[model samples]
Target: MQTFFIGFFGLAAVVFAVGVFRTSSMMRSALALLFSQTALGALFLAMQAEFLGVLQIMMMATEMSIMAIFMVMFMMDPGGLGGMDMSHQKRLSLLAGLGGVVLVTGIAAYTQWEGLASATEAAAADEQIRQLGRELLGRSMLVFETAGITILTAMIAATAVAVKVPEQGGSHES
Candidate 1:
């Protein structure tokens, strides 16, 4: 059952991720990215990383919403109503993508990851949650701070992308 779910969402993640770039519309691309990230979150759940899974989904949902908003505000055809050309360097991208896959496959096949703890070593649910909290707020303070900074930066960038200077002779207020 676990294996089935893992494979299902793993495939879904790939499909939605591809959909992100395959679509012509910026809004649709953002939505596809959101679904791809959510699929990854489901995979994480299958592996029992519940906290990280939920965090992944929530962060992507927020980030993609912001991206869609900025696109709609800034782009002339956010919905691809003009049937804008979205494809670019297709053959080169495919070759590079294939090379990347081969490299990753080689690494996964040959690498020996050492000293990883088994799932049984982890505490029960409540204790695991407390441990995660302690690690995030205490020993992993830098990570938390970095995540906060990243979110702040994204918000700032969205505002910058979406906002336009008013015309000198025109009034924004009515």
Candidate 2:
């Protein structure tokens, strides 16, 4: 049933999200975050939001893949095989996380949620997605292209900054 799958994916997402924070390895943390995002996408799909589910999966897949690659390239020990401590400011982080949870819970409990969507609204949402796709590939294509180029430029700049050049008479160090 849809409810069962939604619950399953939701639980899976929460578990993987916890794994992201609990892991000591940068690579494992990135992988856990990826799994969490993918589970959230599955949750959306179980709830019948096709566009969001697919988008979440696709975007997170690419982003996390890039993040893992960067981690492997930049980290001294991305795999945590050396038993490195990856977390910092533990008390502050815990307090902040708890505060966030309390705030969100309060808001959710106090907010007025407007019931379920009707069939017509659902259809309109689907149509909106189609219109959005058209605009993205049509009038908004230039903007998207520009954004893509900007991101690529930033990535290149980061890579350049991260790279080290050897001296004329010295050897390069890993």
Candidate 3:
């Protein structure tokens, strides 16, 4: 059952990832992205990483909701009005994607995976998660905080730029 669900979610993620790019409407694309992220989270849960999986799903839900709201509010045709075309430089993009796949495959085929063999013992799931939390929040706290602040700053700047300021004497609302 677990194996089946893992495979299902993996396949769903791939399909939805494609949908993210192929959908004409911004809202549809955002939904696709949300679904793809959720599918990936399920995949992680199937692999027994509960914390990361749940966090991924929750984060993506909030992010996608905000994204869809922004798209609807700011975009001229959030629904793609009349089937807006989305792709650009298709041939080059396809070639680049194929090249990336080939490169990654070659690397995976040649690499020696020894980390699993070096496990100290059969550690419990929760302990492993704790170690991950320590690694992220302890050793990498600065890096994580920097990334969070950077993203927040960017969002603030983008909102400021997108917002329409009413002129002093003019009534902006018609």
Candidate 4:
């Protein structure tokens, strides 16, 4: 059953990756990214890392959804089905693709070589959860709060930059 769940998660991850790469619409890409993160969280749960799994779901899934909603609200075409302005920056796109391929390959090689010996270690759920909560609040609390603040600031800045304000002066003043 565990193997089956893991395999399912792997398949879902692959599908999500394909969607991310192939979809042109920003909304579709965001959905695909969400699916991929969910699959990753499931994989963590399957490995008995319950705390990490929950954190992944809470932070990635929920947070990403909110981010996507903000993006949709601010974007010129929220649905992202409209034609895009891609007339320029072909070279930049090609360079980015090449960089992404290299990074993916590097990650694949590292994971394959490092293996998963430690990932298979088992522990009681209660203990694991306790340790995770302690570490999160004790050591990583500041980092987590800082990240939240950063996200909030970015959202505010984006909204302010995107919104257009009208002048208060009357036309007769000209």
Candidate 5:
């Protein structure tokens, strides 16, 4: 079962990577990235790292959905799936992305880490999960509330920028 789960995750990751690279539409790329993150989360779960997996799903899914919606709302010809206009900005963006990939790959290659000898032998695993949940819901309540407020503010700001208010009454121009 574990091997099957791993294989499934690996296939999902490859498909998402192809989508990210081959898609011309920015929205499609974003969706692909979301799927990639989701697959990674599932992989973590399959490896018995539940907490990180849940966090990955929550944050990446929410962020990608929000960005995709906003892009569709704000971009011209949102439905058009044309190739991206590769300008100097796009070139720069690609270079930055490449640099980030190299950096992360390097870090991963250099890191020396060992996995738990026995997953079942971990002390207080259940208690640790409970503690984490308590901390997130209790001590981190304010942080979560603030994040909601920030999202609300961003929505209002986007609306203000995109929506034009009509004049209250017709006025004669000089």
Candidate 6:
């Protein structure tokens, strides 16, 4: 049952990932990415990584929404109404992608999984969650804070760009 769900979500993630690249529309691409990330989160949940799954879903939802907003604001044709091609360097990109897949597959195949901690050595769910909270809010707090500030800055910039200023010559004050 678990394996089935993992496989299902994994396949869905791959399909949506392909959709992200295959679509020419910026809005569609962003939506595809959101679906892909959500599928990955579901895969994590199927694998029993509750915290990671929830975090992935929440973070990607917010990130992708912001991305879509920025795209709509900044892009000349965010919906791809012009039907322009979005991809570039096809041959090189294909080779690089293939190489990455082969390398990752080799690594996964060669790694010794038995050396990792067994179920007996594994911490309980509540304890693991507490440790994760401490780890994130402790040493990793600065990184999260920086990311938050950066996102806020970007949102402000996007808003500024989207705003339409009055023409200097057209609007004369008395």
Could you say which candidate leads in TM-score?
1
* Pick by TM-score: 1 or 4, better one: 1
lDDT winner between candidates 1 and 2: 2
Ranking by TM-score, best first? Answer: 1, 3, 6, 2, 4, 5
**Tens-digit lDDT track of model 5 for 1-174:** 988998899789778976876665778878899999999899978766778788899999999999889878877755445655534576788889889989998988887645624445433546768877787789998898899999999999999997988767557543
Q: How close is candidate 3 to the true structure, as a TM-score?
A: 0.75
**Alpha-carbon deviation at 68 in model 5, angstroms:** 6.8
How many residue pairs clash per model?
A: 0, 0, 0, 0, 0, 0
For candidate 6, write residues 1-174 as lDDT tens digits: 988999999999999999998877999999999999999999988887788899999999999999999999999999998988867899999999999999999999999977974664446567879988898899999998899999999999989997998667655753
Best by lDDT: 6
Question: How much does candidate 4 score in TM-score?
Answer: 0.60
- Local distance difference test, per candidate? 0.89, 0.89, 0.90, 0.82, 0.80, 0.91
- The predictions' CA RMSDs to the true structure, in order, are 4.6, 5.1, 4.5, 4.7, 5.1, 4.6
Give the Cα error of residue 134 in candidate 6, in Å: 4.5
The residue ranges of model 5 lying beyond 4 angstroms of the native Cα positions read 1-11, 25-31, 49-95, 112-130, 167-170
- Superposed model 6: Cα runs more than 4 Å off: 117-125, 134-174
- Compute the lDDT for candidate 1: 0.89
The alpha-carbon lDDT assigned to residue 109 of candidate 5 equals 84
lDDT of 1 by residue, 1-174 (tens): 988999999999999998988877999999999999999999988877787788899989999999999999989999988888967898999999999999999998887755553444446667768998899899999999999999999999989997996676546455
Candidate 5: C-alpha lDDT:
0.80
Which parts of model 3 have CA positions greater than 4 angstroms off? Answer: 1-4, 114-117, 120-125, 141-174
Q: TM-score for all predictions?
A: 0.76, 0.71, 0.75, 0.60, 0.56, 0.73
* Candidate 1 residue runs with Cα over 4 Å from true position: 113-122, 142-174
